[model samples]
Target: MELFTVKSIGKVCVDKKGTRLKLDKEYIPALTNLEGFSYINILWWFDQCDHSDSRSKLIEKSPYKDSPEMLGTFATRSPERPNPIALTCANITYIEAENGVVGLAYMDAEHGTPILDIKPYTPSLDRVENPSMPQWCASWPKNVETSGDYDWSKVFNF
Candidate 1:
């Protein structure tokens, strides 16, 4: 695979339900200057994940065993994996900052976690229909039911 240099890395602070996360004020100046960007691609490092576990090297059952049968890390969204990286598409509500510190959207990542990269979420290019998922997720529950509340706080902090 080709490697791309990362411009900056940031933490994805999400609530329990996996929604809105807190961004540092330092990022405010850069993200705020842009307009017409309603959504963004969140690239984060799953620092909390134990990459040392050999089991995380390849893949296995859902980290939460009760959720599904065994599967590959690439196949599932489970945080356990070799790279321990997580990516998500989030809607950008608005940018907030004081004194041009630098804060972006609130996401479901932890503080201090490395932000691999941030790109404009282009609907025309990113959105795909009927993409291949996995058998375990064949009948995946709705976001609200699976993770529960779709509220911003719950979604990003979880």
Candidate 2:
């Protein structure tokens, strides 16, 4: 088994929920300018997370502590697993390094998390149709409801 060494980690920032991190988008234009690429694949470490001890342990429960029966960690995006890391496909809305900023939407990562890597999100090679998602993701549960209001302090402890 060969291991790859990373060159560096990019900008660190938290998620809107204040529980996760987001990476810098400043490399996109430079990517397009140099490599003619538009989109990217973002690999980030859920750094604030301490999942090493629980990495081998699997759980079926939802992070919110609600929902239904136990589902495998891989079956659920519980953020608990062999590696407490996550990736997402995002559209690079824009990158303004002159101002030292990058903008991305629909990002689920939190602030200050280390950005492991970024690769162009190539749709030509990456697009798929009707991907099979988990059962819990199919529809809204009848019994599940939300009070809506959320307090970050109570939900996440640093």
Error of 1 at 59 (Å): 2.5
* lDDT, each prediction: 0.57, 0.54
Q: lDDT by residue for model 1 over 29-127, one digit each (tens)?
A: 556554577777777777778448843467564443234555567766667776676786666665443442223444566656667666787758987
lDDT of 2 by residue, 1-158 (tens): 57756533565554553222233455434433423444556787666555566676587454432345566787665566777777876555565544434466446776555677766766678776556644544443321122123343343222
TM-score versus the correct structure, for each prediction: 0.61, 0.61
Worst 10 residues of 1 by lDDT: 148-157
In model 2, where do residues sit more than 4 Å from their true spots? 1-8, 14-38, 63-68, 97-101, 140-158
